[model samples]
Target: MMEKKLALVGNPNIGKTSLFNQLTGLNQKVANFSGVTIERKSGTFSAGNQMYDLVDLPGTYSLIPKSKDEEIVARQILEESQRPDAVLVVCDASNPERNLLLFSQVADLKIPVLVALNMVDVAEERGILLDTQSLEKWLGCPVVAINARTGKGLNELKAAIEKAKIPDLQIFNPQAVFSDNSTAEIHDFAHWLSLQSGQEYQHTESETAKTDIKSLQQARETVYRYKKIKEGMAAHHIVQSRERGNEFSFDRWALHPVWGYLLMLGILIVVFEAIFKFSALPMDWIELAFGHGIALLEQALPDGILKRLLLEGILAGIQGIVIFIPQIAVLFFLIGLMEESGYMSRVMVLTDMLMKKMGLSGKAVIPLVSGVACAVPAIMSTRSMAGSRERLIAIFVTPLMSCSARLPVFTLLIGMLVPARAAFGPLSLQGLSLFGLYLTGLLGAIATAMVLNRLMPEKGRSTFVIELPPYQYPLWKNIWISVYQKSMSFVLEAGKVILAISILLWFLAGFGPGEQMETAYNQSLETSLASGMQRAEAEQIALSRRLESSYAGLAGKWVEPVLKPLGFDWKIGVALLTSFAAREVFVGTMSVLYASGSEGETEMLKTRMLQARNPDSGSPVFTGPVVLSLLVFYIFAMQCMSTLAVSYRETQSWKWPLLQLFYMSGLAYALSAMVFQLSS
Candidate 1:
């Protein structure tokens, strides 16, 4: 049977996406809409014998085009070819009036739609009672009260969808409210909408002169709809109870200028500490597992390049990334909690004044905050920003926000340099160090934005308007799904890059040009013997020399001089080169490079890094100063190729991305040099 197409529509931040997730489950995929970079999410599901294809349309406040997202929604609903078999209009049960505007507009287009009254539980908590039957009667369609969080009322919603049909009554008649001169323009617009929806225009032309749609006529239409809606709502008793509740009382403290910032800081500290402390045991287990696996493979497999590739190359690289999954999951889980609780919006409000001063749109806060997860998506979120100048600045500075990819890198280096222990009460010392690195990124972004704001031409004023969602306990199911998706996304995306680089690096590090590797090995044996070193130690030295003379080593040496100023050796130089593809790959690159030389050593990557010695000076390679320098560099550097590509795509110009690359890299080098030199 052919699948019926359904478009899920709603205002931003409602339960639309949650409902979509419940309906489609794991059958969804995200892609770009035709000829546009805006993300399109669609999925398929089977209900009984019939299948359905559900597309989650971009959320908008109205049918009238105000933004790119709104324009797309408007076009999709109005255009006959693109209209779905039915549109599912998800509305907030608590504030039905605001959402009803959009729903009424969609109903006017004559499409079959069912109102999924989401968050009814939240509405009940706020003492707002919704009369579904009254609402259904008033709208002339089915109304399903659904709690998208817990899958409540889902079966009923699905049942409603199967029998969905066009509304029995029109919500408003524009000609009834519009004056004579504007009646013609309003009638023409109605005609246009009908023609676009593939319906015959039935309105009589009381005025022959047709003109353009004016703001005055649009205002009259909106005013009339709301007036009729208010009367009908009272008549039908759709909203049985109303109360302001304690939201304002909570917001007073949460949005306070002083206590709010302090609360946010405390929350962050607790989160980071939780990440380090909670994930430690799991991380240890992962490391131990990989170590045992490597040992077993060593004992079972015969000595050959295949064994070496599997053990030192593929396994080592993957082990580095996999060991950090617990920490990654914990990080995302905590972030989800903050977002789900609606506290994140308060944080945005707190930073609004400061963001505007830095020449960012007040709306730019979302993109900047989202940068903490990953910059590629964060940069894309800037499309919703009102001004071009604001969007450009946001894209340029977003990568400076330390992403989850940098989490592993920071955790590794911090684990090596700082002891994992509580300090100054319950706060973990290592967590503080991690927090400091993130703070550095935020400060860097702010400083860069101020500079860019001065240099760039101002095109338009940026307006900041955001509604604070009511506070509620995070739904554990939603949190789990979020954490799962984010964690897997990181693993799958980073694993591909790490795997390919690991194999290529193994080949380059295992074999050298000509007889250089052979000569180095022989000379290392001779030197070790003359120094009276043990046989095992001498063999280890020989392996190290062979690696130093290999192609990868030669490449590292070529860049060693430039990096030496930051207290980084040739091995670090190699890791730096690989990390340009991805910041998280730094850990995997270090794993492969260290594992190849330490043949037969199955210790964790942390132990390997901690025990590393400078080839020339014989001093520890990752000293406090050097590790600090490395952390500083990663904090500011534009190391992810994906982010740069996204920036290019978003800006539609190489000029911005290239400038971003050079500018951020240069900043990273300068800051790292200063950190190392000053600390030394």
Candidate 2:
């Protein structure tokens, strides 16, 4: 059955998306149609026997088309063919006057509407008593009070909607209803608003124009008076209470430039520690489980090229990429949680001062923080940033943040080099090393931004402006859905790339130039037989030998000489090159490569990496320099394929991505070379 469509709309930062998520649950897809980059969030929910399509619109202050985004949003509202069945306006209960002004504007469209008085609990806590009934009567629409975080009043909101029938509203087009000459006095507001509306106004120099401006001033005053009447005085008192009542003032400490930065540092330290400590167990389990499954696939398939492709290449690549899904999901979830709560605003407020030095709008913090998950979405978040220079700068520098995709490489290398033993205090030396890796990556991003700011100076004066949203607990369902979607995309998209590469890699290392692979396979078969071992172990040994003699290994060996000075064996060299497309591939490549190289250990892959040796030196290969070099390379390199593609698309040119590739590769090379030279 075709579902009725409803849309949730609101000013930016008011919990509208959260409410949409709560209604739709996990049945949602975020995508863009046509030109705009705003997330076109559409989902289906079954309220009764009927299904409904709920679209969560981009949050904006008004339905006025300004930039590409504002234009898209405004056009959607005005289009007669695609008008929603009903529109639900989400408003901050504590900030009703501003919200009501917009609400009245939407109500003028003559569509059946619902006013969601969000943050009502926060409003009440500040001694603001919201008369929802009065609000409903004032707007002639259903007024629902909801705390999207706690799931409060959701059922009532839903029931209200179910009972919803379209009502006729008086269309009040402000432009049509009011026109006067005194536009000179409020010229700034008019110009700012006209830009949003995409309208051009003609001004003339005359006393009559002054009279006209004064008349328009009177029109605006009339609108204000009507707005107040539409919103009861009692409700005004409630909202005013909220603005003045909160005792938890941050002006003293957390807002201080010095103290704010310190607190931010401490918060980041905790975040880094939590990501490493919590995700380790799940990651290990994924690695182990996939390892066993791949082994089984080898045994079940025939001893030929197809089996090798299926077992080695596809499986290897998938396992290489999918293992990091948990970490990526965790990172996105945590960031989303921080954003849903009001704390994100405070960070932006504090950082705008420093961001100015970097030629970024304070709003650039959104993209930068989001860069932790992946650069593509992070770069897209710059839409909220007002100025072109700030957005461009954000796009340029966001790639340097170590994304979740790099976590696997860092973990793999850290485990390979730094012993898991505890260091001075309770901290594991490995954990501290991981923390250092994060710092290195962050420093690289900051340095890159600093340099870029100096070189490509902004043409216009760009200032940082960010809204401080009220604090609330993260809705778990909303967070889970967000985490799940991003994690799934990483698996489905990167998984395909890794799977193909892994299989090809497996084939190369699985089968060799000729007899060496066959001969090794035969000897393993004979040894397993001589020892009377099971068919499975015998098969494993054969597969291992075939890989040792395969093209991938030969490729690794041929390149080993070139990489030896870079503190990498041919195996490490091949892994490094392949890992350019994906850092997660490092772990997968090592697993497959080690499986090809090793003779005996059929146990855990992690143990194999720990015990791995350099063929020439006959000593453990993963020394501090080797690991440090590899980690440093990943820290600066733009390794994610998706990120490169995004950079190309955003800039509408390949120049940026190509430059990114050259500079990152050069930086990785020089830094790794240094680490190797100093340590060796």
Candidate 3:
């Protein structure tokens, strides 16, 4: 009845996680590595009569680790607490040498090992003949070829796992595992090792035998002498085989500097169009439910402060945020799909040269994609960038990606006011505006990275190394689970903050600081001109005066002068500023602000927005200039508190999050001001 633990270990992009997911299904869970914030994923399933626990470990090239992630994997191997009962060593059959380099290291570790030869289909397509039996004979392990994408050979792999036995461990082959200087050195050492007898390494229920220190040192020396020769042989084989007779389906053409960029842009446009078209229905449904709730709340209660707070403030805030869920979910789904399907690495591959110009590795692509959701996770995703400097640049620039949180604010402004017009022969002007906003985020991020390259001292070779995983159809279950999890997390975490802000804004705007509002209301009633008309005007004036005297209103007025050119008055300036905590807050704040002193029939939310006026100028607000300005602001602004919190955690510094805040704010202000000025 003992619980058996198994680990799926492999090089990055090997689809090890996909196999793990296929096996575990809905039984999976995520946790932080024992002491580190880096996450570890695990799951359980019943295979045969036993309950099996599967752990997906961090990937590494070899146990002799370099970066923090590699160190974590190596440490887990050494530590008793994380010891797995058996290890599934995953490899790509098409590129066996690189995978074998990792496999050879794992084989020496002396654990219960099973070799998963992934991408066998690709190997066949490329005309590479893999003799699994010969490989098994050479490595002294069970070799199971698999296509994780199609569930092919999964049963064989599982059966192998169920019946596996750990072999007597081999000593580390330093010549093969580490750096080498000459081929002569390798041959001499291989002869020397052939002359000496290897001890039979053993493991017990409790302990693995200590590796011989003397032999290990000798192996290291031999490897240092011969590794260069081995690497050259591997490269030569790859080239001669591919060039002469066998041509791989994958090509260098995919990474060509000019064509690759144009391809990436075209793909990006297609993705955006898909996102917009797909998310429409869900967005409409969300908007309708939210609108219904607000109406129901208003109808259920008598006119009072509590009713007003609930109807105008809290309900409005909820409506502002809920509409974004579908869009954000779809965006995350598309990103996750790209990553899983392996197109993401191609982007990283293609962009590596460009990244050098911006002082980063193409590996920064991870964070760049993750930034679509929130900048925090995006920044943390830079852990794979291989250097602190590159990672830092990725962190600093990632916030400029205009995360999904900005969708609500942009959607509200664009959809409500921006009329449909033609920007070109066929494209809608509104659609072009949307694309422009997204481009602003992208251009600003690249600009910031370029400027930082100039400001910061750069050293060390930031080589961009990545694997282009074999392409496959996007998995439905995995995609659905990812979309659901990402969208739900946003709703639950940011929703709580937004909901609180809405309630707080309601209280602040509904009631005044002192007895000033009461006195103001009484005076307006007493100074009547024409009885009925005077009473109505007095009530409207009192509401405005009360709001002006309120805490939120006062704060708005204080910042109004600085923000005026963005086509925002005191009220709008306040809403925009408060929305820094969340973009959705602007909608909620506007709803409540307009609801307070209305003279027209309040029906659709759009109608309410249409009637809002600038208090000082006494002119209609939320016009073309204001709507365009707002869209530009949201496009350029980093307005999500979740994104800031994430950036703080990922970069392990307030400096980064603060810099992101100021950078985004400055960009937003500059862009918004330009739009407003041009339109005016």
Clashes of each: 0, 20, 4
lDDT per residue, candidate 3, 1-680, as tens digits?
77788877898877777787788887877666775556677899776667789887887665555456765665665457877888888987777766776665565556778888987776776767666765665566788989876779988888788655554324444455444443335443223333333232222234336555545654574454335324633443532333122342444555557776788878776766666688889977876777677778778889887788777777767765676677777777777887877778888877777788898877887678667656644665576656677778888888788776666566667776667788789888767766677788888889989999888865534655566666666777777766666666566656666677767767766666788667766665666433555565556655655666677788888898988889788878768766766776776566545643321122344666778776568788878888878888887777767666766766677997888889888888998999999998
Higher-scoring candidate on TM-score, 2 or 3: 2
lDDT of 1 at 298: 98
Candidate 3's TM-score: 0.78
Which model is ahead, 1 or 2, in terms of TM-score? 1
Residues 1-680 of candidate 1 have per-residue lDDT tens digits of 89988999998778777898899987887766766666678999877788999998987777665455666787777667877999999999888888888888888878898889998988899899989898998888888999998899999888888777777647667567766564455453335344233111222344346433444455677787788778878998998999877755778788777888899768866875676688889987887888899999999999998999999888977875676578767877877787788877787787788998888855776677667767765676677665567788999999999987798789889988899899888789997898889999999999999999988865445556677878877777767877776666556655566666667777887899999999998998999989989877677668767877898788888999999889898989878877776687677567656653332233477887888887667998889999999999999999977677777777788999999999999999999999999999
CA deviation > 4 Å runs, candidate 3: 119-138, 152-156, 159-165, 169-259, 293-322, 369-380, 411-420, 488-496, 514-547, 561-567, 596-632, 666-680
TM-score of each: 0.83, 0.78, 0.78
TM-score leaderboard ranking: 1, 2, 3
- 600 in model 1: Cα distance from truth in Å? 13
Per-residue accuracy of model 2 over 1-680 as CA lDDT, tens digit each: 77888877888877887888888877898877456555588898876577888888778766545345555555665567667888878998877766776666566555677878897987787777677765666566788899877779988887787655433334343453345443334433223243345332223446354544433543464466355545554543433344455534654566776887898778766765566667878987887888788778778877987776776566656666766766676667777777766667777887787888888756778788777767755776676666656677788778888887787678767776777899989889987887788778778878877888888744545644456665566677867887777676656555565566555555555656657888878888898888998886577657655655677667777888877767888777767756756776666567656663331233356676657876667898777788777788888877766667666766677988788888777887888888889988
lDDT of each: 0.79, 0.69, 0.69
Model with the higher lDDT, candidate 1 or 2: 1
Please state the error at residue 580 of candidate 2 in Å: 3.0
